[model samples]
Target: MSDSPHSTDGDTSRATLARVAEQAAVSMSTVSKVLNGRPGVAAETRARVETLLSEVGYTRRGAVVPGAPLIEIVFSELDNEWAMELIRGAGATAKLNGMGLIVTQSGTRHAPDPEWIDEVISRQPFGIILVMSDLPPANKDRLRRLQIPFVLVDPSGNPAPDVPSVAAANWDGGLQATNHLIALGHRRIGVIAGPHDVMCARARVSGYRAALESAGLPVDDDLVQPGDFHIEGGLVGGTALLESRDRPTAVFATNDLQAIGVYQAARALNLRVPEDVSIVGFDDLQFSNFSSPPLTTVHNPLYEMAREAARILLDIRAGSPVGTGRRELGTSLVVRESSVGPA
Candidate 1:
């Protein structure tokens, strides 16, 4: 008599689960709880079960429902046009794939809230799109155990090497902005940099420095002022640079909001834009074009980045071989009226 195929599959499933439980030193119920993402299992036991599951390539059976699949996109905050662009891009892709999108604002720029992972596991969405740089290792392991895929958009800092991410060409944007100013004969250039700790910020600043060096210009520490990717930081940094004894004729704000702040700073000091101080900003946001004298800026491709991230997540769901490395979109310089030959 031949063994039934159903019997063989059932036996194999049982054996695998039992082996996982034995190795984790937990009861079958405990293993089930960990697999289901229930609250009763002890943290340590849950971790052990998750690790063993990953090792054995055990995925929860039938976790994804047949209809009403969703793709969750989480953000640290959604106050600016930057977030809007990302949402538009990802939402459009999700719609085309016949999936609904769930947008959430939870935790900080670095990682999502602790409880967010449990909720996600329970929901069992098709995939996740996180606009954060760092994800906790435990959360990553849990997602892997359940076979839920995720991709990062514009990661805040340096994420793990294996995490899939999409971002703009910050270094090139910085270099382009600086080189554009240099081409206009502005030798003494000032840069209002973003937060020092952010990876994109660091890369942009480095590009600025590289441009100056390539032009045989000294990298003056005093000319590089700190910003917070906000208007206030630009206002403060721009004011200080403008008030210096040897102020730079051109200023590059790391972001559009800071550029607006720079505009304000120049106005308060009765300095005419371009005529008094040439300005360049990043992230060619919509409002940047409406600013007086129209802001010259770098196009950061936020929409494209988000679209690519959504595609990557979908590819993971389809079992396609999307690599773990970052997919960087290009950035270009959009010169309007803000930048000009230095007076």
Candidate 2:
């Protein structure tokens, strides 16, 4: 029943937990936990109560502010060019800000294991950035209950409605890639639609279809094949497209990796690039420049996207304004030697 020191600012009466609770619009138990700097309350909620106490010239009995004060970056795997680029961007931002970053791989693409989620909670990071995947609702709820902020970078599927995300303009990139081929006077264009379940893949396909319709061309079923955004899918899908009797003159693979595999398929069929068949790919990866005759592709800045995601996550932690739940960087088309008028 010890009353804290009195406030000399206008009112000389000591502050009471009841008054704090009433002013904060929270229960007595919540005020108690906040004053004790307990982990049960939300960050924003805790910030609000702390602000109110400071304004009223009231000091908590023994509370220092509670913040885990670490940033974490989670990924499915960290073994690819794109992944390396993402790490560079995020790491650079963290270094400049004098913040330490914790990197972890979930060891699975579809989702992180339950133990991983538990580990995240135990660490209690200030913010988290999930690359190439989104947390399940249950996992997200756990984070929410703990009041930890998180964002997704290039999630395989659409993020939760309230979740924050950063991504590239997959649809626009797709449209531009297709349009570039069409402008080259290639009427019969083929496309390798990426994995069926990937949101970006579906978007690219839609863009390809839209571009074809805009050019008054039909989207032929035989011309659109499935891809997995990897070499194997490209090799298999590309082979099927090239073997068709009514094969397209040009093909747009969902990504550069797949496009290179397509080149292997074409070479097996004795089809020389550009002279016999034109190709356009997405993701202007470093390897794209060295592919035979080079590659005409869309440049998706994965690094910049990662940097921005880190910046945005920090901004969220600071309680600043984020324009939208989702942010998408623009993409550009790099016309290289791999594309030309079809023979």
Candidate 3:
């Protein structure tokens, strides 16, 4: 057989594979095992082979292999309603396109575990949708070499530029929420912000500050409290703000869960909703509407973002060009009974 390199239909060349195997000091059979996602290879050996494969730019056929009609969705955890909304959205889209959905929970917000990519290669799904999760460079290289497409549903608001992603307009949501409070004749507004490390949280805080400044109100540093996007964070932050000698008439919690915590804090302090202190929250979660004196919050459009991310992944899989590979959905304010004009 001729050793001259050539590619047909985007499949890796045989000569190139031979070179990769030689450099890794492995036989062609061992390389084939790694390429096919078969067992019997040592972990270190597999990683070395994968790195070499990536270095040589070995890519599989672009077309999906026969019998693998699956689209996988990855999340850090599945305990909350947020994950459920995303699953529903992506699952619906996948079914409509004649594919099954696979849900995987692995790793933290930064990236998935090292072995997760190997499992994915074995499955060889049609595409992948990652919600609030990222992949390391080696894993990314493996996916590229396999011609598998992936998209991120990034509520965190920080996504890699080269990858396709869909995110909500978090800053705009924050601005709208704060503006609503100001329009209700509130002179002092407090914000319970999410973790400072997250881009979405920082963007929301910036928006709140902008709204206060634009409305000719002072941006009091004391009114800005740290949170963790959870009820406990909200409770702690809300308690601190409410206990102050000169407390804010209105408060904005970065997320719905935090807002609920604020409610608990207010109740413990013997305050009535929207009477003693008006409140607003972000995310517009389903439970937000069921709270005593329903929550006035921002509609985050999590379901829509998931659907769009799945669509983009499918489009990439179909060999279509996606310009910029980034989409930001708009947010709207949902007025409920929880916020009112300060007395």
lDDT scores of the candidates, listed in order = 0.85, 0.79, 0.84
- The clash count for each model shown is 1, 0, 0
Tens digit per residue, CA lDDT, model 1, 160-260: 67789998889999999999999999999999988867889888898999999999999999999999999999999999999899999999998999999
Q: How do the predictions measure up, each by TM-score?
A: 0.87, 0.79, 0.87
Candidate 2 overall Cα lDDT vs. reference?
A: 0.79
The 10-residue segment of model 1 with minimum total lDDT is 1-10
Model 2 agreement with the true structure over 264-334: per-residue lDDT tens digits: 99999999998999999998889999988999999988889888988987787677887547878999999
The digit string of per-residue lDDT tens for model 3 on 1-343 reads 1221222242345677788899999998998788767878886787888777766766442222321578899988788888988989999998999889999998888787667887888777878888863678777776766667888888788888778889989899899999999998999999999986689988888899999999999999999999999999999999999989999989999899999999998999998888999999999889999999999999989889888988987778667897645688998999999999998
Candidate 3: worst-modelled 10 consecutive residues by lDDT = 1-10
Question: Which model, 1 or 2, shows the larger TM-score?
Answer: 1
Evaluation by lDDT, superior candidate among 1 and 3: 1
- TM-score for candidate 3: 0.87
